[model samples]
Target: MKESDILSEALVKIKNYIAANKDQDAPIVKFRTPADLDKIIHFTVDTAGVSENEFLDLLDKYLEYSVHTGNKQFLNQLYSGFNFPAFIGEIFSTLANTSMYTYEVAPVATSIEKEMIALMNSYTGYSDGDGIFVTGGSNANLIAMFSARNRILPDSRFEGYDRKVKLKAFVNEQAHYSFDTAANVLGIGSKNVVKVKSDVTGKMIPAELEKNILETIARNEKPFFVAATCATTLLGAYDPLDEIAAICKKYKLWLHADGSFGGSLILSDQYKALMKGIERTDSFAWNPHKLMNIPLICSALLVKKRGTLQHNITDINADYIFHDIDEIEDLGKKSIQCGRKVDAVKLWFAWKYFGLKNYQKRIDNLINMAIYAAKKISDHPQLEMLVPRQSFAVCFRYVPKFKTDLNQFNLDLREQLRKSGKSIVNYGYIRKSLAIRLVITNGELLEADMDLFFKNLLDAANNLESKCQLELEIH
Candidate 1:
């Protein structure tokens, strides 16, 4: 069979798998220990090519063991579902197999990336700002930190880490932990990445942020940056950007909004107020791969200051590779990576098909769905809300009114549901309380599914408790 024929057959199997998953015909994954997995699938190669028939057999086993993210029951992460337009763009870019380092070879890909970044900047209220697509949210955060460091201490780009500067980066207690890694990489100690306190809702309190800044200054630490999480991971709360921006202005600090989860809310006029005063921030990072339904690893770090990233990042001197062409058009020079993937095509194609209005409706629908789920839990006698609904992520717990250990009750409940293969909602500790973090992200997930999921969850909890009691009595 031709290669295309082989792939077509595989896609058919995948489609069937997705269709049957809703009816509980397949488990999310045929999970196994590594020792067992090695016995089932021929994973390692012995430096020899295999027959095409053998290849098909190996592919079947691999697919059977793999976890299906497109399945309706999948609610494990911040992202879910397969977008058709984005799928097409991904396939086309893979087939083209071009690097986006130079315009001489990748003119179309480079231009497409530039257009997408330009769009993000425009949405961010940057008149002549700049942005770039990065590998992930972590890298995007690093770019923001790097730019801020160089901008403030202009000589730090060339100077060694020993430069007479006490550099520090601040993040709300709820912010992503990437800044700690970034600080270590930039030669600043992890201790210098100060953790500011947040409110009960997981939002950065501006007064607390200013208090930390003043304390850091008193200790002679130069506070160059502060990252405000637009939407926290577990609670889904947003920091008050309008108040935080005022602090940054007062202290001459670089304010960065890490909107990896809630940034897409900007598309919806109604929800965009969550990011009020965003335009005033020095830098912003957003991941379409999360809420916007793009493929994984599609993140953009936008800046209000034009040419700032390029100036801070670009280290030029190679005449053979980077010739003196229209330098502004050369994107690779501005980025920290040399051969960036053609990551923009998927986002651009998805945007064209969905349009701004549809994206707005999609965002609204997510929030609405999460709200509905929260209500179902609240009304049910078996479950209780842990955190109020704010974004798509609803943090709730299963409670069976007899005053049992709620934490262990939730832990066992999560495992029982996962082992049964009926659903996939992971648990976490939010504010010292165990919570089932359900993000209403799958496009196919509906109200009926939510109702059934909750029912099954309660049934599993009761069944597990009965089993435990019977074992104890017998002993």
Candidate 2:
């Protein structure tokens, strides 16, 4: 078939699939054991030879197989459902197939990316800075840490830490795991990434941070980088960025904010206070894909120092690639990846589709939903709120009245919900205790959806309680 015909057919099929499954108010698939998966694979795949129609059918099935995370009840991971405008923009991005490196190849996309980065810098109050769109939050953090490493020890990249001094990157205990991962990838070792203690509310205690810095220095370790998490992954708490920035400035350390989850709040006037003193930081990792509801892989690493990343990572000096132009700073020179995807197009399109104020309104709605859910959970006698609602994620637990093997009960309840395929909610341990986590980052979700989720969650807990009682009686 012709490409146009194929594209039209695919779009139609996608529309049909979404329309049919959009109303599904529950999980799309139940947990399957190994034996069950073996049987399912044989019956579905082995029994029929593949054809175009069959392949499309499989596409529909597989697409809808997981918990419709984009569905109203999906509270599992950080990223939930798809945004309509961002989705459409992503389709266009794929069709364009442009690389972000060269303006000659992707002139429009390159300009859009630059403009978006400039807008983000303006939000952070960076006067003269530069940024680049990265694959995700993790990659952005890596690039930030890598740039900081190179800035502090200019010869480390080439000489492999010949300074013979232990370099340390500091982060709060409640910070996302990405900092540790970045440290490992940057060859700094996980031990060197000091975990400063966070208060009960999950904010990094500035005094503790300063003490740790002094201690590290006293131990003859080089303390040069500190990563402050704007919104923590587990509790959605924002660290005291202003105080942290003060300490960073006092020590002359490179301060980078991992605002992957909370960065979108920059658009909201009310929540922008959470990121106060962000402009003082050296670098920032922000993800529009998270709370902004843009498509995935749309994260940016903004640096206050204009050419710092270029100084660290730029190695390619081919005459053909680096021909003298009015703008000497090609984006490829600054980025870790050479042939990067044009990930900024969808975000630019999203911004265009929904104006900045409207986007902030969406963020405000999600934040309100989070607060509403926290209140609802707190009011429930059987449920206990683990963390205060800060941004969008609320951590809580279904604590039975009688504390008979509560951990086992909570774990079993979560497992039963997963097995039944009723709804998808996640449970995690905080401070060696189990708690359920609900992330309200999806802009498409409404208050009514949250009501349904809480209802189902309570029903699931009650069912698990009855089952446990029955087992106890039988025993």
Candidate 3:
């Protein structure tokens, strides 16, 4: 068979996978144990290459077992659903197979990356800011911390840290684990990464942040970085950015906002207030892949100050790859990675297709859907909401009329739903209660989809109780 035939077969398989997910009767996943899946797939590579037919067969098997994240019922993580224009852009990027290092090779992609960064900066009130597409939110956060470290200790980049002075970073207790990883990557021991206290709602308390900064100073440690979370993982809580900024300003600390999960809220006129003081932040990490539904790994680290990235990460003296080009400089000068992927095209395609206004409308609809789901869970007789709805994550759990361990019951219910392939929602612990975390990141989610999830969840619970030989009495 020709190469075109192979491409056609692959596209057909992808098309079928996408269409299958839209059907309400279709399972979000074909449940498979790790051992069972290993036995089913031919994992070993032989000495000879396989034929086109065999390759197509392998592709079919891969698609058949993979979880259908495009399904509207998929609320398993921070991201779900799919964008057609972005998917096409992903295909185009793969077809080109060019590195995003220099404008000489990837002129259009470089331009797109710059324009995308400028557009994203405008939303954060960064009129003269600069940014680069990164691997993910974690790397973005790491870069933010790295920038802070270099700004204060510029000599540290060349000659290691001054052992006499202890450096410290701060983040909300509810912030993503990336901050801890960031500290470790920067060689600033993780123990020195202070965690400020937060309110019961999971928002960082400004007063506690100030107290921590003062304590760090009293201990003779240099407090240089403070990170405020736009939306946390478990509760979807947005830290008060304006207040945090004020504290950071008072301490002269570099303030970075991690909006990886809920950063797209800036597009919504109604919800943008969640990140009100984003303009004052020194750096901001936003992931279009999460809430914007662009595609995976579409994350950007936007620095308010122009040339901040280049200043922080200067390229080594390598004349071979770095050419003094006309007017435009290579993107590699500002990036940590030499051979970056063209992540901007997918985002640009999705943004162009939807436009800013339509994107806002979609985000507003998602927030409304979250509210709707929260109300449904709260009103249900057999369900109990673990926490008040914050942003998109609605925490709730099923409560049977029988005396049993609520935590274990919810765990079993989640597993049953997963194994049955009816619905694929995630679960997390809120304090001590294990709550079902229904994340509303899918822009295509509708009321009917939400209802169907509830229906499947209740049916799964009833079936589970029946199988356990325990009568579930309606409370």
Candidate 4:
């Protein structure tokens, strides 16, 4: 076939595939494992030949097989649904295929990314700031920690921390696991990550953080960075950023906020107050993909100081790259990555398509839905809530009226739900008690869907109860 014919055929197939599977709805896989990798690989690659038609067919099949999170019922993870404008922007980005390293190569993308970063800085209350797009929240966190590490100990990048300083970092126990992972990857021992205690609602205690900082200093350890979680993973709790910033200021510690899950709320009037004092922090990690409903792998690391990031990660003399530019510097000098994608375009498009007011309304809708869900769970006779809804996640479990072994019952119920493939709700243990967690960050979900979720959960529990009773009688 001619090249034009191939392109035309491919476009037609893609359009047909998307049209056919756009409205298909189903439950997400309640439990996932590599149970049939051989079959999956065969079906995905071998049976589906490399022809354009075959590839489009395979795409359609996979779309149908996967969870319809964009449907109004998906409340599984931090991210859900697709924004139409953002999707269009993503398509444009793919067609452009520009990297943000040099203006000569990606002039438009470079300017757009700089503008996007500046807008984000304004949202975080940082007037003069700089940032770079990372792969995701984890990579963003790593870059933030790396910047902090390099800022405090400039010699360690060359001499290695093994000989110069035993660097230590701190995070609240409720902070995301990525902090520990960052420390480990940065050669700062995970043991040095001081996990301070949180209150019942999961907000990190300011006094506890101060105490830990002093204790670490007393022990002759170099305490350089303190990471605060704007919204925790488990319960969506917002740490006391103002108080934490005050402490960090007093101790001269670099403060970073892991707002990857919660920073999008900066647009919401109801929840923006929770992120106060964000400007005082040295750096922040925000993921538009989480709550903004943008495509996956869109995260940013914002540093308060303009040139701090450049100081930490500047690379010069690439000969072929970094040629003289009149206006904007090459983004590569400040980014942890060398070749960066045009990930900011989607976010910029989303923000532009939905004005700030509309975006704020969307966020407010999710928060209100979360509050309503929490109340419904609390009012339910058989359900017990672990923590109140702080942002958009409600942690709760099915608790029977007369069960002394609630933990065991909850754990078994979670397993039964997982095995039954009815719905996917994760389980977590708090204060030695097991509880089911329902996260409601999906922009597409509604109160009616939450009603169905509760109904399905109860049905699953009832079925499990009957099975348990039958087993007891048989034994």
Cα RMSD (angstroms) for every candidate in the order listed: 1.9, 2.5, 1.9, 2.9
Which portions of model 4 show Cα errors greater than 4 Å?
A: 1-25, 29-37, 40-49, 162-164, 401-408, 415-422
The TM-score measured for candidate 3 stands at: 0.98
Best by TM-score: 3
> How much lDDT does each candidate structure score?
0.83, 0.82, 0.90, 0.80
Worst 10 residues of 2 by lDDT: 39-48
Q: List runs of model 2 lying over 4 Å from the truth.
A: 1-6, 24-26, 30-50, 326-329
* Model 2: pairs clashing at backbone N, Cα or C within 3 Å: 70-81
Report residue 428 deviation for candidate 2 (angstroms): 1.3
Give the local distance difference test score of model 3. Answer: 0.90
Best-to-worst ranking by lDDT: 3, 1, 2, 4
Off by over 4 Å in 3: 468-475
Clashing pairs in 1: none
Q: Which of candidates 2 and 3 reaches a greater lDDT?
A: 3
lDDT of 3 by residue, 310-380 (tens): 88775479778878769887888899999999999999999999898998998998899999999999789
lDDT of 2 by residue, 1-475 (tens): 5557766778887786556446754454557776965664434446557766656556665655545555666677787776788888899989899887778778888889889999999998888999999989989898888988988888887777654678999998987888889888877888889999999878899999999999988989899899999888888888998999899999989999999988888888977888888889999999988888776788999999888878886367676865658763567777878799998999988889998888889888888899899989888888888767778888888887555776778788777776766667788788988878888888877878888778878888898888777878898
RMSD of 4: 2.9
* Local error of candidate 3 at residue 143 (angstroms): 0.4
> What lDDT score is found at residue 456 in candidate 1?
72
